[model samples]
Target: MEAVFLIIALALVLMVFAPVAPSDRARTPLRLRLARQLHLWDRYVYHDPQIWYPRD
Candidate 1:
């Protein structure tokens, strides 16, 4: 039981501290990706306006 708890704690720490890539093509850590998807980190995450609203 203790070992399982330790493993879970370690995984949580790793996920929280994992690095995120700035570019869309680059891979982002799961935690950060989820935050972005939920709009929790929108200020910190970059969104290219061109991608969302392209001028005709």
Candidate 2:
């Protein structure tokens, strides 16, 4: 019982913290998905303008 609980907890932690690579170009962490949904992920994570914007 204890081992099962520990495994579940570990899986949950990994799921929350791990970075998810989608089929598209972006790779985002699960924990920051809320911020991404709110359009604040890049603002807080990428400080440089060049990171979010590219030169044309």
lDDT of 2: 0.60
lDDT of 2 by residue, 1-56 (tens): 79976875575565556656656877665547645433553454467777569798
The residue ranges of model 2 lying beyond 4 angstroms of the native Cα positions read 21-56
Which portions of model 1 show Cα errors greater than 4 Å? 21-56
Backbone clashes (count) for model 1: 0
Clashing pairs in model 2?
none
Model 2: per-residue Cα lDDT at residue 56? 89
Mark the 10 consecutive residues where model 1 has the least summed lDDT.
37-46
Kindly list the per-residue Cα lDDT of model 1 for residues 1-56, writing each as its tens digit: 79976875576566566665566666866766656544633542347676467799
Please provide TM-scores, in order, for all candidate models, with all chains considered together: 0.37, 0.35
